[model samples]
Target chain A: MTVHALKRFDNVTELAPQALVPADTSRGLSITAQGLEKSFGDNRVLRGLDFHVPAGQFVAIVGRSGCGKSTLLRLLLNLDQASGGQFWFGERNDAKPDKSAVRVMFQEPRLLPWASVLSNVEVGLGDKRGTPEGRALALDALRNVGLETRRDDWPAVLSGGQKQRVALARALVSNPRVLAFDEPLGALDALTRISMQKLLGQVWVDQGFTAIMVTHDVAEAVTLADRVLIIEEGEIAMDLSVDLPRPRERGSVEVAQLEGRILRELFRNSKAGEDA
Target chain B: MSAPAEKFSNLTQWILPIGILVVWQVLSSIGFIPGRVLPAPTDVILAGWKVLLNGELAKNIWVSFWRALVGFAIGGGIGFALGLANGLSRRSERFLDSTLQMIRNVPHLALIPLVILWFGIDETAKIFLVALGVFFPIYINTQHGIRTVDAQLVEMGQTYGMTRGALFWRVYLPGALPSIFVGLRYALGIMWLTLIVAETIAASSGIGYMAMQAREFLLVDIVVLSILIYALLGKLADSTARLLERLCLGWHPAFQKR
Candidate 1:
């Protein structure tokens, strides 16, 4: 379950030089973390961890429940302060993480039930600051997600997949440099989930925003991520790069092999815990 | 759920009330129930017609309507403001909620004598009484609503960099509205009850006063007519609140018929 074991894969890709350059000159903030640690009282959730996500790179973090994968995402999101660490955004070594530059789509759509579909997307722009121009942007974002037809519908009326699509639209409407997905597709049906994964991949590729997805679904990570980080305990267990090209086929030999490897890593840690 | 079954169910709803009215009317017409005890439907309608012709009923209805409206505005407005203050701020809740809770416990009716002493039998006393009665439900419901807004949604709002005012308007207020409407509906019922009790106890004009005046003369028809008027007014208030709830909370799952 070490980085050395992950190096066995022949298809493992190295960071491309172009990815290091910001994809969108006006947006796309790169992330760097050094000895990141988070604790609630004495129980440390994320013990000292280091990683770098190049601008616009799609990285997925996979782990068993309570392995601090989500905590790491939250720290990167600045939703919670890290107990100890140096986390910076962009190329600058001292750039403080900006809230406006980062947006997160949660396990639930989290659309305001009181707002219309269009208004819900407009919420991504942050409150009353959403002018007519913002509304047009929101509409365009919905169009990107293929939910423009449901612009006036209530969230309650939307199906689970549709709700997640709306949430995706909301997340992208602000044109955030970084988009964090906290198991956003975990709740969808099998068919719906696959379609959504494709939609998400297409959107991410087109927008060229840095994506950090945390998921229990190892296969999903392999299918969508440019690189997959398997977290064991509070640290990164395996940081395997997926050299596979875009529009990855489901149940392909390579994807299945990567999925098996990640699952094995995940199960080994749990088995070790049980032994303890 | 089918169309024919839905039609049947709708029809069945009116059957019981119509049946009761028929039985009551038959019994009263036969004189089995004395007119002195309870007037028949015909007698009540006749008395209502008499009042209508003289414009007495319109005058009394106007007087009562204004009192309820003015009192509700004062009480409901204060309740809503205080609810928001306490709901949104821990400091305000700690300072004000206990005092309000203590005041809420004393039956608003019990303060009628004190209110009369302070404001006399003028419109002020009745309005004050109604205001007192209507405040508690609105305040309590508003607080509960705001406190129970989905934590996840609030966190989402914060992550989106919404300002305090924006969060309150976009998240807190809409989340609290359904509960606030529940309080308003409850307050409307209490508003009428308080006005009825106040008018009956001491008042120069209103439906309650007309009923009281009728009772002394043993005019059962007029008394019955007044009670019906009170029922109609209560229904009117409730329907108005419900309509407002429908308009404001169209996005609410419960209100989404389809």
Candidate 2:
């Protein structure tokens, strides 16, 4: 069911991971955490959290505000150090993983206002920047986001949705093995959010990167993830696999049922906390 | 906003200055206003022409302009470098920023007496005063600019594997540019103010020195001519700064006219 978008993703030869993924194999990397923990002074954000995400799987972390879902995403991306416990990537678990294999799209577009759309995308190329191949890769990334024509324009001119698309392009340019998002569409309006979700889903299917997103929206969680993980009290409260067909309708019975299950799990814990 | 309205506004801006000149000329012609009190526009223009012919005006203007520029370069340069250092490193800020802030609180002009005593009213004392005068605004603004750069963007840069150098060039510098330009514009104004005071109090030759000599002789026309030159120079410096801001910060929405 989730495989429908795979066909459309194959036509783009330039970004289809040339020899990087060994042709037929997935470029995605699996992530495994063993008793992960983090705390900010007295506030324990991630308390003994444990989960394993397989290669190329789409995982959505859903929870209420202050549930440490965003904190978990940050730890995965190494934006913050874990106070306790160990986590490592698949093959890289045995060796020192290059940090380049992980990338993130923030809730804000975070596009460099001073850089042009193309140059902003090129910034993702890291050391490869300022080279012709890097330029071509950046242009390809822009094309991926349907912003190829706006390569020369400053980021300030683009709309919020368009800016996020450029940011997505920048994240995808380096072909990360694991991509995490921290409520990447939380700021968008309803219509733009829907479109962005669709774009994100399509990109994940095409890129075959291990996709993980932290969001509060239950419907968004069901509509996107292969597996939905609800976080509560700095722990994974519920782990449910979504088996619905491709392009799951937002208001459909099955999707709504899944969303309802996750929502109940989330509210139940919050209710319990309030009672105690 | 329309073409004709913009044109009218432009026209209105020049009308008052020109009108004042005309009214003053008329009053002076009728001898209602004496040349000793305030010279007529014609008298001032003639005085300006005489100085231009003898090259005194050019030499004085050059000296003042050079001093202002040299001071700006030295002060603004140190401000930029130190601000960048303090902004990028907390240790540096802890060590240097307090001392700098303490120095900033003292009025730079108040040091003129001490400066004259130390450098004997030579070019060094004058340049030091101007340099000190312009330093604080640029330093404060530059530090504020770098410090306030969105933390989210810095995090994003780090996750994307941007090296420290890459992050500085691609994110920190560009993000801080608008604020830096604000500093530059503010510093330019102080540059002229400090130069004028420094030159007036002492020195060999400049517009300020010329004005002092004119005052001693009671040459009101020459004094008025010196004032005009100072105004013109100030406007020229401001315009140059604005042009640079426009060029460097074209990406800023405030600067995008088109």
Candidate 3:
């Protein structure tokens, strides 16, 4: 029975792409948030927040703590319902949340520690097939992240960097329409963080999925994202498109200028909020 | 530095037990105690062999083993049912938890006389006593296991849109397995202990009966041999439980890393 499951799982590569966008559906990417008011009791977190992502866009959200950057991501994922706003997926009507096309990578690796690297990746496949076929697809996903050799190894045995790689493999396995990264590399050390930043950019370029990342780091926003969206007080304060070349350097003049601008906007917002 | 050294290092853990056994055998041989009151190690071995040759010891061992196994099965089944139901369902927990806790406070050994009166000196009373003794530990541990599953893992399952049944099977059961195994091992140990006590009090034929019969006849060697058999059997049950824990929780973080 497990061998049959393995065969079925291996067939994911053969299965027709379920995410084939309709040719006539000109509306490729749209995220509508209107009257998006959220509150934990009396302290309102997000107030009338709104944003949109065009087709195949790389958007990075940068903000200080308690500016509701995380909350905004939660709203976007539909993990938590908005108090008043209607959130849509790919220009779909707000009738219901179609989370089938969305994949989220949390800040924590959140890899099932008991599972092998291959099986963990297969979790993204859902009930698309049985275990073995899912496992084969999982192996393929691991290959994409250069972790094929460690397929049979348990999550506990993997290093932090390797675990995050496994997490990336898991997120990408199902081929979701939008890959939502919730500060996915925030926990890594400085050296590993930069390396992962490069990996993220490469994966984003290869996969060509609409990516939305939430990060506190301005350089990260400037380095990887096509457009940097600075959110302050549950509002988009700055949404600037990065006109820099591929493999943008952190110490480069243009990237530094952009990072400074974003940081200034964040500081100004924080001071104003405090005074209010 | 060499193969012998490596072998010795690997076998070092058994040194204390071996030493204790050797000391015990020497003390018995050197007339450290009277033979009638405390039979020599060799006399105990001779008595064990004599009973084995006569088939008396084997019959008694089998009888006790079967009783304990059956009683363990019944009590473990009921305990698991109650534990899972109460652990998962708030309404069930509210209704059953207080009552089970109240019952758990009553000692199983204390209930032996009442049990004998209620069910008579037949196998039913002995099995009942064993089952009653084994029940609480398994129930408490199983409940603890279910309660201790990571809420984050459950949320992840929910986000994946798993059905309630699927959630129970995949997330809840596997997550609770380590704790449940702990309870299982504890209950298994209790099963043997309770069986011995029950058999000594009322059994017609068993290791306990042999020990009691030998005591009456003043056959110190047979009594000592019977005690050895009991100890060996208890060790076997414990080792089996440990092996099962290793098998079942092979994937757990603590076990996997080790």
Candidate 4:
């Protein structure tokens, strides 16, 4: 599939209702990427990618490893800049200071081993510089994640699931506009993954933060996402919406159908890459 | 069952030292060891008490302790600064790390001949020697601690919008403290060892000099007493370090588990 040239959308007003706004103007960040291009030396990672998740939407991005799922997530968070194309948060362009309102959780529960579980979450508070406000905010965040009891406990003592829960607590405590997950539950066992998925879905619903999760699991994409955007060859291959109601079931016919469609697209994408 | 196991281990710990003392005391009582070469523990204790009462032993001990303290402060300060510089900057590390490593390989003691020549066998040479001895272990450990910090934590810090300075102070320093502490403990050992050696040479005062004098006079009891003093001081310094490590790194997972 040929990568279309990245179109730089000059102003937020030019796009449709769901077009991403520069966070400054919209007072919210609903991520939108259009013709996003990324390459590592000679290897193009993301090619002319485009998608939009309205505010408070739970979007799951699914693709095989090396299919640029993580690259896209990183792009949205500004952890990395795309080589070409325009990505917007809310309705504004990329230059706004409002980008601080975004946060991310990685697959590894990257809690500071030397810090207590509470302090790890409080890292999202970003620089107490010895302030009472920082401590209060950190405590509030720990309480939100239901980990206030383990606040004083070191992260090393936490079980794997508990560690991830602490990480989730950390992400939420910041009260970010957008929470991006880069395969957060990919490392978990089947049972833990299911519970975490349920917990995540409930948290997203309650918090009302626009969340974009990158996953390779078809069922996870179907069960959690409001829309599952499948990437093939570094470009979005399918942009299918999941109209399934809240408290989604993994075995629901709609979920199974969506999962099957994603799996088929994944296989086809792999073959296409192999042929290339 | 567990209580017996605990008692057995505790017994095992003390057995060797107790056994050695018993055998040594028996041999001394039997007169199998000459007093010129070997002194009984009781004789050594009596000699220690005599020196203490005369105030000479206390003065010597104080002199050596102060020297080690001053030297440790100076060398450790410079080592920490240089290590942080090299650790943080790849260019600085590439330029200086090899040279530092090479200098580290040259035993600080080997420089004593030149050091004495330069400083004329006074307090300066001993202090400089102690400083040099303490520098390497602290520097190497500090560098390792900083360099080996988890990259993921750094990235997390960045994502949270932490300033570069905040990143270093909060994430980097705490992460590096354990390795740095290890270096400090090792450096402390080197400080005492170097001070003793420095005091051994050309010193009118201090423990090593007094021990040398005792050896010359064939005062075996004083010699044994001085050696015991060195061991005790070393042990004291080590315990202090361990205590500090526990305090500073108490939030660490290892301590939390305990």
Candidate 5:
């Protein structure tokens, strides 16, 4: 089937708009990319990539700098145009997915510094921002992130970790089907990063949305993700299933083995490129 | 902070200005300063009283005040509109920026002779000059603010389903506010500066005209009064801007300073 140069999963969903998306068995949505491609001039960032992320699955993508991990997330998040091929969500792909059901949590809190914490969370509701229900939902999301008391405070006053938590609430307030995180904790200190990792994991468990996180930290990738996909030269070099229990001890034997495996693949590719 | 501490801090601000006033008054009264060339502070006060009795002082103040405000609205209104347009849309910038930049390079006050020739010694000339003086600061700062709104924030807003209009309201406008306020304060300073020049050069009314008139009669007290009035008005405008900044940018650390 012929596809447009830029496509967002605008097709009709097999299930109803509000039905379970890969979380409840009766209804499910999936992100399917078939030989998806992207390039900027002579530089090919993603070359014929393919993957299917089923509903409620937490997938972490890690790669060296410029490995197109971010590029893949951008394409999925509808932030950039794909050079060729197609990717879409839901059981059938024709029209794009519900726009409100997709969101991206950037590395920066991107919280409107001018807005209060609750108002920032309400930003995720889009048109519903002015509604009372939207306000209540935002407050609830803030509570889930343990920031209900700071709802009235400006985002500037909150510590860095707290700000990221507000950002997380903003992502979750809409009950989105797909949450794409672009290294949301990349700027955080080590201890703060660990706490944020826990919050991110708990959010996924409770929300049940499909999550795609791009990170440089292999340990974080192994700890939080159900599946870890390592990209090299714009292709998935390894797709390793974590197959571990929730709250998996960080740096445990199982986690370390998976981390090492993914790192070796990435390192081997970089060394090969250097030689060439 | 406690109320006394707050009051003490407030008093600290007045110390230098009050001290200067007291010293100047003592010097003038003691004959260390000549009354003709430089009037005593008391004489300046008496001149203010004389103007108050005749009510010309109010009329002149009103004229100058009105001129500044009207000019600000016209030049600044257009500037703000263009700034947002040019800042948000590259095509608009491409179409209009070079021309505006060329116009901006010409010092606005330098257009005085041409402005007077075009509009005569009327209110139009003064207001036009004032408007021209105030436009560039607002335009340049507002455009800079909008252009520099974090691209990441804009992208996040888009993914969250903000419409084009929503993006401006929720992201671009708030993001650009700090810089816009910077422009507003600067424009206010220029508004007074421009009005002073225009009124002093050619006007039958306004504080500047009164000052120019006093020079002929050597009523140095009224001249000093006019200069003092300009300082007070400038301070008033600045405080108002600061108050607004505090209200809007309470989230900012700089604005929240005690």
Candidate 6:
């Protein structure tokens, strides 16, 4: 069943460039993982998993808490090493992780309270980038997030949504090939979440980085991701594609149907767990 | 109206001190309190004026000020370096923290007798005492601050591809600074206390030495003046530290009101 789902996903990726809107294919790195396993002592978080994300694709992984979705995200970002299996970025599959090619926005903004919003974004550009050029790039990112006016403000002064926008800017300032988000908008209010969803979709389209997001909000997954993956028991139980057009309506029938299917899969597992 | 309200508040601040001064002056004039036990405020002021005119007050104050400043710098520098070393590396902490913790328990004042015996009532003994007294607060607080820095922010820095040194400068050091300032304010208090004790025990100069010399001759007024000088100096040091905290940690929530 998993292989069948993966084959369908491959078909979608092959059809994506021609069938749907043509995404910017020049800037993203393809991700490939085979039999990726992670264990903490006796407790195995991720049993074994295989997945692939094409360059410039926006994919969302949704699952119940403790299904190792976050653990998988961490492994992808090289924050934790896999116990076994091969993960590749582009063509390189060596043990040495390519940290500079990827950046992440956590559930919280994680902005250094001591730094101004501009300086926080500048941190994304490591020392190799010259100071003046880095500052210009950081400012450009802030402008993209529509927070150029707040460049001098401290993170403490920002609203929850604004802080997340700063986090987004910081993630994008370095022009990373892959952007990983671990529930980046989970803390915002409903209205703010909608607006941020629009902003994230727009930015991902503009920058065209291979975007992977792990979230529990099924509706969010359906609305934003071009591909929705439902992970169950450390495995991809469902790999479905959202073929809807960009700027999707929130309460549209197509979006609601996809959300319902994803939620049913998530709840079915939780119900089974309770019965056990 | 707001200006008057502000003026009223300022007046309220001074009311108690002025009232105490009046009571002291009246008691001294009426002979209700003996002057020998505690000299009158006027007598202290007059003694202070005399010392000031003769340059004794300036010289002694300068000596004590320089001693505290130099001692604090040495002790604070060492404490900050050690804190960074142990905070960043588990190996350094394992090798050094236990021995330092054991030594921290010993009250620095208890070493005065040995210090004097070793250095014999010289500048070395006095400065050593002050440095030893100031060291522990900064060291312990700095280590505590570094350890307590938010782990999520550190992880964020790592994911951004910061080198270890860059992470320390950009994240760990800034995160620990507020706590370091707290240590600094506490250490300033100890700096003055240790200097007073050290100068009293064995010194030819400084405010404590002058006060001791006045006591030998029963010059109660000069002794009272010296006490007032110590109080003023302590207040000055505390205010200076608070000003620095305001300047450096303006982003801190507590300091943001200004």
Q: What tens digits encode model 4's per-residue C-alpha lDDT throughout A62-85?
A: 988888999888887778888999
Model 2: per-residue Cα lDDT over B1-258, one tens digit each = 789988998799689878988999999999999888998999999999999999999999999998998888899999999888888899999999999999998989898889888998778987898889888888888888999999989988888888899889988998889899899989999998998888888887899999999999999999999888888888888889889989999999999866
Off by over 4 Å in 3: A1-29, A94-99, A131-133, A269-276, B1-10, B256-258
DockQ of 4: 0.58
- Model 6 achieves a DockQ score of 0.75
The stretch of ten residues in a row with the least summed lDDT in candidate 6 chain A is A1-10
Which is better, 2 or 4, measured by lDDT?
2
Worst 10 residues of 4 chain B by lDDT: B249-258
Order by DockQ, highest first = 2, 5, 1, 6, 4, 3
Best by DockQ: 2
Give the C-alpha lDDT of model 2: 0.85
Instruction: Tell me the TM-score of model 1.
Output: 0.90
Q: For residues A134-252, write the lDDT of model 5, one tens digit per residue.
A: 88888777777778899999888889888898998888787787888999999999988887776676556556678889999999999989899989889988888888865577889
Question: Model 5, residue A129: what's the lDDT?
Answer: 86
Chain A TM-scores of all predicted models: 0.87, 0.89, 0.85, 0.84, 0.88, 0.88
Poorly placed runs, candidate 6 (over 4 Å): A1-22, A92-99, A128-130, A272-276, B1-19
iRMSD, all candidates: 1.1, 1.0, 1.9, 1.9, 1.0, 1.0
What would the per-residue lDDT of candidate 4 be over residues B173-235, giving only the tens digit for each residue? 999999999999999999999998888876878999999998888888988888888988998
User: Share of real contacts kept by model 1?
Assistant: 0.88
Q: Which stretches of candidate 2 lie over 4 Å from their true place?
A: A1-25, A272-276, B1-13
Query: Per-residue lDDT tens digits of candidate 6, residues B134-251?
Result: 8888988899889989999999999888888888888999999998999999999999999999998789999999999999999999998988889889989998999999999989
Ten contiguous residues minimizing lDDT sum, candidate 3 chain B: B153-162
Q: What shift in Å separates residue A133 of candidate 3 from its native position after superposition?
A: 4.9
**Candidate 1 residue spans exceeding 4 A from truth:** A1-27, A96-99, A127-130, A272-276, B1-19
* Candidate 1 Cα RMSD (Å): 6.3
Pairs clashing in candidate 1? Answer: none
